[model samples]
Target chain A: MRLALLAAAFCALAVPALAQTSRPEPGPLTIAKQGSFFIGGREVKSDTLSTLPNFDAAGTITVDQMYVRYQAPAGQTGVPITLIHGCCLTGKTWETTPDGRMGWDEYFLRQGHPVYVIDQVWRGRSATDPSTINAVRTGKKPVDQLPTVFSAGHEGAWAIFRFGHQYPQVLPGMRFPLAAQAEFWKQMVADSAANLPTPNPTVPALSELAQKIGGTVLMSHSQSGIYPFQTAALSTQGVAGIISIEPAACPDPTADLGPYKAVPILVLFGDYVDEFPRWAPRLKSCRAFAAAVSAAGGKAEVLALPEIGIKGNSHMLMQDDNSLYIADILLRWIGKNVTATR
Target chain B: MRLALLAAAFCALAVPALAQTSRPEPGPLTIAKQGSFFIGGREVKSDTLSTLPNFDAAGTITVDQMYVRYQAPAGQTGVPITLIHGCCLTGKTWETTPDGRMGWDEYFLRQGHPVYVIDQVWRGRSATDPSTINAVRTGKKPVDQLPTVFSAGHEGAWAIFRFGHQYPQVLPGMRFPLAAQAEFWKQMVADSAANLPTPNPTVPALSELAQKIGGTVLMSHSQSGIYPFQTAALSTQGVAGIISIEPAACPDPTADLGPYKAVPILVLFGDYVDEFPRWAPRLKSCRAFAAAVSAAGGKAEVLALPEIGIKGNSHMLMQDDNSLYIADILLRWIGKNVTATR
Candidate 1:
């Protein structure tokens, strides 16, 4: 079984002397409740015939909704954590890792925090209307009017995800499980959110989720790193705390920092930022943002894993070999900073 | 909570006198192992620039794969069941009902069967390449070359899914939980399987899954009802049993029944088939197919729920209020007909 193989590999790495012994069986997960729901979608009515071959599109339909799946422990202790995935991925990003390791969602749940994972609008389980694209193909709409839909190729993702500087090349000391590279590629999906509104539908949907859940910690990664800040800017009604991991963009230092001042913030970066051309600038921008927050009488800690004696982390720090080690660091931060609001 | 609302409604219908009392809490599920994996995809090599704004597509990418999520009970006993969703839906169809009730996946798991729910190729968690569409949008490919991607409209799906004769017209005594109509509409998605080769990539992928798991009972619904037959025709390597629920099309009655002769087959139809124009012919075709299979020395049963005194079921029989009642029928059949293979 795949689990057996993973257990063996894990034991060889963690306890070489005890590698020969069989791994202990994992206990069943206990949870008080688990379910899914949609949030912040609006109905769009169309009168024209749809792009579907045999169907007429003369009815109301919902679009731009975010899908949230939640699991709460039997005796919850920590504040609820809402996880927003980056580009080209879905809630699966926080699930079982590429190499079958327990992902952050389960890890956090086991650590007593109710975890809510979301698939941003227009991606994964969150559906998007493709009528425009179909209209373009049918000449009902001009090609120029076609929405921007793109998929990340393996090579591009390899470089951008910081797996290596080039395709098929593993970075030295990188903690990514390269043996499961194929599985990682499976996580790549066609991202259609580029065609959404200026602030993106996900921003409003996330804001609505925060308010709906009363108060919760918002954790984001990569392309979605700025969502929590933007959500706070719109209205910090239920935004209790913010954790941005390896964000591709940070808020402009010149922008008003009032919305973020009251919220505890953590901007985290993995290793190889200084060595990777693309990530180095991102890290610098976040550092400036953190400084701006501090100048505005706010608390913001910009953390680089290497500075904390944690090494060999990639852009996908949560999925790396030392993922739980990083998670422990995050747990400690949450315990100290984030108030139990949920 | 949504669960509380659903529980209250459920109690009102089941036991009117007891509706005043709070519904008992659902006990935690005991799952042995749960995870997801991709199956039956191939590397697609491209030498041209990708449709992405900043990325080159000059590399290998995976497509036409199926995503499967599995959960096994703590002490599994029954044969594994592979649940394939109908058209315009995803694996979410088997997770939680539109009205927030326990889905068939959990019900089957509780019945001691490992449940494997799949997002068919080009749908849900299964990733599809958008390069061709992007090519057309960017003028790199002709509009005619664009893939046939279509999304079902609310009105169209309403009639087709047999929710009613027309939009907003519920069939008398239908069990589709009309109150959650909005939630059901959310299940509609853009289906891109038309872009794939004949027989669809999901056929081979599902067959491959059966083989990989050694053997499994293939339970398919609506559009996917024929997949089990098609998969078996290709190779019955891992197919132990077949349960086709309201298939739009059935295997050709005249086709070779060699592969199906040994496999126990159950073709089930929900209520309103004889009265609904669209479903009337489909039921006829499946009845013919079942008769043909029987004539060819195969065990095939064509079941109409009304005939068995189980009435008021819709096309989405599994999500209906009496869904578990239907599932119980299935469990009894499996107990008698399906031999444990995994």
Candidate 2:
């Protein structure tokens, strides 16, 4: 009788455990003080691919573009991922070795979604903006790290940026001048809109390609995460959903994320952030975004991670348990939420 | 002879211990994923600084920022962190049970660097654009109980964003009209440039605030660790260094991160990260960002996290010794790096 009672008690305890969310309850969401690190760069030893591009020509366009290849699942028509590279790296940063897995794309392919990786124009293996690069010759700044219209605490740097924005046409810092920059940007935007690479038919970034391929899911990490908002706002087609790694917060809450109204966004921040904004607070931005989306009657899921140390945790979740969690969320959503049945 | 041998062994151990980072080494940076939450209706709960600026009026501006504040050594400067939130969460998400103090931020503050919290736009109490909000009222999909952009996904909703460009006149909502959105956005873009808020010398995100308030050093648990990248990237004056708790990764390496770069990024991914990016993927983004930045000539440090279910393995690290370990890292970073004394 005593042994039976003990067994019964254990069984009861186990039953309760089965109904739990598996992890401890998380705290509320707040602003975060974090720096932004996006994209990956290839391990290029020599300066061969490092040669800078110029934007100094009167009408020539100096555009920087990144390209990547992501393999898709053979048969499943699922969500597609279009990755954009951030500042200093190429798409290679998202790749890692864990449990002997080959790459993120391969892992995702096995689980379902097709991967479409894109190298943002400028930093990694992509084309560089020559005019900005050659700005060093103008002696304005030692290097051309600052982008046009960027504001910083540095007075001289700010002034230079302001001046450049106003008269970029006349600035002499490129193989192709302001005209080239503008034209290149226009073309890039058009290209992104018109033809998203079809790594697989499900690659949503390529609407036509994805439609032909079927059931595309959209995913981004770091700097590339920003593209989803841009693409969703600009594109004519509908995407399956959005998955973002660590994306940079736009200084203007109302400004940056204004386009994605009903888009399901999944944001996962690091437990211990390294940097905070010089102008505002992190929680402020986070809350503002969440509130804004909810106020618009949209769904926004936030996961404040404690700590799982995947190197690509900030960019790609393929190796991190967080990614699996997100993937599960997607699976659940697709199974029960979206109108498009898998 | 036995006593001498024992003493010799002790000395050998002591020598290596004394030769450590010269300060404290925060707990390892790892990828961890736990719990799920949403950033909904939190906007109605914010402390408003100004009146609701018209989302449609010309010359309107809406800004959302993320930063942090933590308890650090009285004189510490650049601390470390782990951003712990989803795309829709803010530093506040780190707030739970034992109150904000028991929260990750407080835990780190007790250790050294005041936790830098972030509230990303589209989540938490941050602002949102009205035009993007209009997507919820679409004729194609079902509304009500609608997930915010952060929680949901779709290309049509996200298509409105332009990189580095913003519409300050936009408000948050799904009720705004389409034609009105275009006019509103156009007017907003044109008018926004006129009355841009003048930069303030008194405030600089959180670090400067902490510096003025007198503080130094930092540490974090999860997503909060990733915030440093943003803080560092946007800061007029960069941080000395950072010590991460369980650091997150950037986003997809295939995306663009060249715009934001961190010189020295440290990571500590726990074994738990294996299922992270799969679950949250955003964690992977944080890791990828670190890789990209490290590739850009910065220091990228990653470590393994302690196992869970261990006696002292609280995620917040307040009850655990992890916060103290984080404090150690901040001490070392401040003692060695950060040439300019705050």
Candidate 3:
């Protein structure tokens, strides 16, 4: 009877073996320093600055407010990395991944690199003002088009990304780590459609962030890929290196990238380009931009996974099943070109 | 010394242990039918059949050949299943995943279903004459188009699948067995581009294969989705049921689906649909087709994983990490609708 009771207890305990999603016992991680910075502020006499309804007041107005979250291991890799997420997403992109796995934020920290993740002005914790952001030269009675934000559902993504041969037709070799897709979809935020054109505020704010944390490596994803490129050009000495993962857009074709000559850059592209027709032109532009950078004596290396014999990777390489494998590659490259060399 | 040699031998045997990629020890599996069949033959006159240096000699010519590999467990389910792969792929799609994991072929076999995997006529072992296939009148010069076939490279897929947010970006929850990518890529074949507009010979050949193996459930993927639909229309009594995974196109919208009224059908869609723009219309069409089937009194169930609370599945649910999970659902549905009800 005792033995039966013991077996029953064991069975009860083992039946629902839920995967533990919590972090391990606290590691030697310390919050070095974290704060907020304001950029693009101009002193102006505003007619409606007061909290009171449309009351006139004079004060300084800031265009954007930037929030920074920095963490470092006890033993740091002298070279720090500042992670910048794409539009809509916040610093959370670098934190835990959708499927509850350690994200690049934690991965980099464990690798002994001081990590700094930031929410660009008017995003996430930085907050936003819809009226100010959507203000346009409309008419006598101004109308605020709160920036028609759009968010993709599952079907839209499956087709555009070529997750499978096409929607519903998953290929045999796709490696997107799809098990955590629900958690991933949660990360999708409504991005401003208006911001597709320019980078006036975001580029300057991020450049300032880089300058503030001098000698930092800039890692950017998707739409924010241009941040590091523009940042490197604006704050030349502040950035040690740049790693761009499928930048939504490319560096200017006409502009001289000479300032980035001394800075090393790695542009990584994953699988399923031919299936999505839109990617062809974007990739071509990126390739051309990289080629121009090389011509300007800049050490820019474009790593298209297929060309390198690596197959079945999607756009989200960081959260992939072989994420650690790719992360190791990035770390090795960083150690060789930035950390060790420095 | 003798003891040391014994220990050394044991260590050598165990030190570099590798996962067994080979088939498991022989189970109670029996080969029901394994052979080739030729269809569509035309006999030429003796004068035309004689071959000379300058003149063409023609004998009896067969346009299509079909190969079938069938296996059943000792105690087989009365219902058998015929597995067909998508474009540029073969029956291997159901055999093993790109990451060296067991595919539905093995999964269903273990579950006691007699499995029939086929190389659609002209693909894989069912070889066809390219010259004969390309002879169709497409343009002015009778130039052999030979189909402008394309196989998506690694990077192309990474972005399109919403695997990571873009190419090379793997998410945290991706269940794709990525380690076996090399083996997976080997299975990719160049499909016939000319067949896009019409099912023609391929569908007929598949239908014949289904007919040859009576009372078989037809499971089709990608380009092959159309085959089972058309096959059911042609070989109505032969196919007991149909399972379509992201069919490239659906049955003719204009045609009456009354033939499939008695047939049970299940259509499954995976994750990241929002990322792919083309999927919207395609999926809309598929949904419409499935709706039509149901309205016509057919038992058609359309499963969008996310809508059903099963998330992060790419197009390739069979080869996914959670493949078994989806398989279980399919089996349950199969049992409840086909096996049990019957």
lDDT of 1 at A57: 52
Error of 2 at A199 (Å): 24
For model 3, what is the error of residue A23's alpha carbon versus the real structure, in angstroms, after optimal superposition?
Answer: 14
**lDDT (0-100) at residue A248 of candidate 1?**
81
Task: Give the runs in model 3 whose Cα sits over 4 Å from its true position.
Answer: A1-62, A132-146, A165-169, A193-197, A339-342, B1-342
Alpha-carbon runs more than 4 Å astray in model 2: A1-62, A98-102, A131-215, A250-259, A273-284, A306-342, B1-342
Instruction: Order the candidate numbers by lDDT, best to worst.
Output: 1, 3, 2
lDDT of all predictions, in order shown? 0.81, 0.34, 0.58
Model 1 bad stretches (over 4 Å): A1-25, A47-52, A57-59, B1-25, B47-52
What is the per-residue lDDT of model 2 for residues A1-342, given as tens digits with 9 covering 90 to 100?
523533442332222212322334332222121111112222211111111121111222212223344444445445655544432233433332222223344344445555665544332223222232223323343432312211111122111222122233222221112232211111111011111232311123334333433444555554454555555555525555555545655224576455555566655453323332321244346547766776777755544432222121222233333444444444545444344313
Q: Which candidate is the best by DockQ?
A: 1
Query: lDDT, candidate 3, residue A3?
Result: 38
Give the Å shift of residue A24 in candidate 1.
6.5
Docking tier of model 3: it is incorrect
When sorted by TM-score, best at the front, the candidate numbers are: 1, 3, 2
The residue pairs found clashing in candidate 1 are B50-B57
Is candidate 1 or 3 superior in TM-score?
1
For candidate 2, lDDT tens digit of each residue in B232-263?
A: 44452435455555543443455555434433
The 10-residue segment with the lowest total lDDT in model 1 chain B: B12-21
